[model samples]
Target: MATTNSLLLGFLLLHIAIHHSVPVEGHPNYSDALAKSILFFLGQRSGKLPPDQTMTWRSDSGLSDGSTANVDLTGGYYDAGDNVKFSFPMAFTTTMLAWSILEFGGKNRMSGQLSEARAALKWASDYLLKAATQTHGKLYVGVGDPNSDHACWERPEDMDTPRPVFSVSSTNPGSDVAGETAAALAASALVLQSQNRTYALKLLLAAKDVMDFAMQYRGKYSDSVWTACPYYCSYSGYMDELLWGAAWLHKATKNATYLNFINSLGANDITDIFSWDNKFAGARVLLARKTLVDKENSFDPFRFQAEDFLCRILPNSPSKTTQYTPGGLIFKLSSANLQYVTSITFLLNTYAKYMASSGHTFSCQNVLIKSSTIRAFAKKQVDYILGQNPLGISYMIGFGTFYPKMVHHRGSSLPSISSHPAHIGCNDGFQYFFSGNPNPNLLIGAVVGGPDQNDAFSDSRTDYNHLEPATYINAPLVGSLAYLAGRYGSG
Candidate 1:
């Protein structure tokens, strides 16, 4: 009897060893977790984060005493730390975070990252509930600093005197707020519902109010006050994001109204951009292809837009372009643009769907190779940060230039052409750019610059006074780092 038992145990041990020896693709957990982690980290790595210690949505009272009201207007405000607070910018950021987290967590659970997955689920739940409760039936441009004595509509005149009017209005709207906010809320509700049916249903009902408000106002996208101008509208270059939120809402509620709304926007309006905005469109396109393709939805605009942009930028070959720099650093440019990594990644995942629906393939291997290059570049940038580079001067690789500043354009502020680091104003604020990299190894992203060197933004002149982390730069970093750690761990 003892000999027989020993033989059985030996056989069990052999079976386990053989399982461990199999390749990762055959290991369901390995494949799923890796995919989830990569997707979440990629999405997060696209945005900026706050420079100051305080979370963006916290009551403004605790902020530094002398901090300017205009500080909230800077891009960093959109990258606020906590998801519990729901303001306009926070709402947008949180929605992106929640979707990524939930998706990652679900994959993690399947891949055996149970604890981490649960934490992500919990964070998403708390955020969605808080956002739903705070907004109730109405969506403002975003939440205000709770500590401020001013009303939601109040704006400061020249950073000193406060005006009675609210800078954001639910009615008489201006920027992409109506579309962007509504889409975010709707997506959040849908995700929550998929996870927790009861809670999600309630949130969906509440979210309908916000959607209704947005739908009631069918004004031109240019009238959106939340963003700066027509150039910033989702249609100008980011219709995908608007569509992503809308698609999720459509899926969650199974509401024909949302589908009809999206259909009316038409595909011709979608523009191709390299940022997450384009991913949003890809995501929605996938959703639409899944749920509405058979419902007589028009395909003309989507085909035209996809062909126009994809054909124009699709690289003919995987070639690298180099430019000489006065500095020792080598700038790497590819046939594919780095800025379009987010959109390209989305397309990679969803291309089959588009092909089936539209009979066109946006096959651009350069997009994928460029993304890998950007990931490599991100590692170098992070190294530069940890090395104590002053004022966090980093380059976007392909451009061979430092971050651009907001310059006055047609009576409004817009990101100017990329310039050298030595030209950036207010070098103090640029240091935050060195925070994290896109690699699984956090150290890989460290900035290698020496401690004392000053970049362009460091000037004590007017440029310094106007400099701050743009929202586009900061939110993605925070989201990406957290997503990476949660998904892939230190490896």
Candidate 2:
């Protein structure tokens, strides 16, 4: 009996030594720092924005106010029965910022920014926790302001209800809730674990439950919903949310169920929803490449399809160029659609990694522009902003045609007005248009211009100086500028 026990002990020690010695797969330089930053930040903080930055944007108070400060509008307009307001877009922004901070830490450890990153993580986590608590496990994806009547369904009046000041619509109900919540919780769990917080395990378990619940509601092919309209379907958003959640869960728990879920989703046909207007399809493809990189299973057809779709959109030649002008400043779109700084950055950073691993390139013409170009564009945009006065940079430009076009309202008995010209502006351009004809849906925000211009402006020429500081227009603009500044730093 003694000899048998000794043999078992020796085998167990050998197994442990081997496991410890093996380098973990997917150990990218950025991932380690990201993990550390997220863990540290979560352990140290809780609800509320850090004491440094003040919320200067407009508030959505009173019947006359049409804007909500610091919030992104997803499901616009609301009425009665829909008493809840979904704040997923705002939630998403927070999640992305938190993820960005962690990812950035993985690559470059900027000293002073650690606190800012920590603050962002804390703010986002609090927001998510509050949302979860408010919903009480019943997912309310976004928040709505009172003015916009809920037109999400056929009968807006029937669903109208007075609850919070914000509006809640069923249009794109809970599409990203599960994925986003999972990401927030996963990040928090990682942050807490690193600090040796006793509750880290519990947070992780809770996060897993949220993720599982979300997965259960994913569409037939495992694609996530953006809204009730099929056109609003998002490719990259869902995939990123899912992969990030799954990857973190797998890493933390090593559970085969999560791995299997990822594989099943990967194998499904997700490209049927692709459209030219949104680059979400492209983004999803890139995300899929990231998710499938180290998997042992044969490369999924959807993964290849995603690559093929990207190839279809690629400019014919690397040398070919397009032009972009915004706020009267002209720039060259040397890489076609690849000009969008964030999109290009994601492609190069992610797709390039995939190319290196697969020993395959998506054709020479389709190769992502180098990281240098992305950095250059970001820098140029930053320079333009710094050159202008704070208010001068307030405009937001609308890009694709799918974004609503401005229509002049005559204020006739028929209700609202229609038939406005479709105009594109620079990143800073802002335009207000109805969500639908006859009745105003809600004013939505969009970024304009093709890939090359450094100038950002609104589609309209009117001076917005008279607009209230607390207006909705200012909040997103502020957030966008803040995001851009963070990405490129003050030039």
Candidate 3:
């Protein structure tokens, strides 16, 4: 008991120190942060590099991704610091990016990140299209072996590791991954409608086919692709994804079939999160719009659930499920906590607009709160991520003068090909992974797994739980940063 208490006391004292040497502020160049966040994806890019590839550090990688499956599975963002291309999170990344564009695209343009954001969205969407269509009634859920890839720390550029492709067919259905891909296609279609109407329509139609497959052959992708377990497993079940995909289909196509399916879903549980694994919260948010725009009686449950989700996440609400740190960061799971922060902040921005445009107010524990409050709370959280915390460091790489230098991304850690022509062998890369030095290449815009419950951060490459960056982490943040920059910041 004394030891535990002593440890606790020591932690408290150290936390109070709060890295005072590191200067920090509430806001610093939101536009710059937005741009860097978009650039982060370039570092995670796999397969062939384009001529205009800005992240010159990352060259062509995983070119023969789907060669094992005899299908082209090149050109998608890596799941995280690793080279393995997990399709579930990749689809969620696309869906969130598209949703951001659909909501705050103008703000993104004002902040001078619209084109990059569009390209980022297209980059993932194009791969999603190929994933769903290339398999011929089958869905390619993942590429590369997680166990082997994780064991070796080499950069994707020279991946000598096994490039096994995993897919789910009618016999082995993966509703979760397929549904997510469908959602990605639908949302991307809406976002890219102006850029290429014909392509957008093609995406919408493909979304329909994939969504139908998900509904027709119902099963979890994790079940089919067992290797994905303990990584990107489907925790909340496949129904949430099906409903999410159906909602996006309705939004894009406005087909009565989709509307009927959503109304039939009858998911009343207020989702606690919107992340790579769970889609319930996102489904509620999207379906809520149906009642607002169409004034449909069938969609009232979704609106109620969506409102409940907001109330549950708010600090003032009696039913609040999300916990906040002393530094005002949204503290959820102990690991990769920033994923929830980004997801919820995006939803708050989206739902806040919905409430403001409709002049609607909701009762949180019978206390009617203004939509502005949610937006304000969201800003505080975003500001906390940029800085304004006890740690006084930006979780986002390249956002501030002092940020994460030891991001747990393999490409960022290894010496760039330009700098060192000598190849770092497979296991040899672990030396860099464990090194205390900063990564050789800057993973700009990459949002790392964030601080602990006490708003403490470890700037160690070995501490992947708190230092690794991901594509999904940056996807939802694009619009939030863009909106803040447009509405408030000079940059």
Tell me which of candidates 1 and 3 scores higher on TM-score.
3
- lDDT value for candidate 2? 0.37
TM-score of 3: 0.94
Q: Name model 1 segments beyond 4 Å from true.
A: 1-89, 101-105, 108-138, 143-170, 220-245, 274-280, 288-313, 317-340, 343-491
How well is each residue in 49-95 modelled by candidate 3, as lDDT tens digits?
A: 99999889889988888999899999998989998999999999999
Q: lDDT by residue for model 2 over 1-491, one digit each (tens)?
A: 99999999988866653443311221112222222222222211212213342321111212222124223222222211122233433344344444444434332343444554555445555445544444334444444332332322212212222333232223223434566566556666665465546656656766677677566655311132223223223434455456546655665577888767766665333332221112344335434554456554443544565555444333433533323354322243332221233333333334444545565444435455433333344334422322221223311212111221321211110111123222222211122222233223212222222222443323221211111011111111222233333443432
Specify the poorest-scoring 10-residue window by lDDT in model 2.
466-475
Among the numbered candidates, top lDDT falls to: 3
Query: Tens digits of per-residue lDDT for model 1 on 329-367?
Result: 222222112223323333432333334444433334434
Models, CA RMSD each? 14.9, 19.9, 5.5
Off by over 4 Å in 2: 1-85, 106-109, 133-137, 145-162, 165-175, 191-203, 218-248, 251-254, 266-344, 347-362, 365-491
Scored by lDDT, model 1 comes in at 0.35
Ranking by lDDT: 3, 2, 1
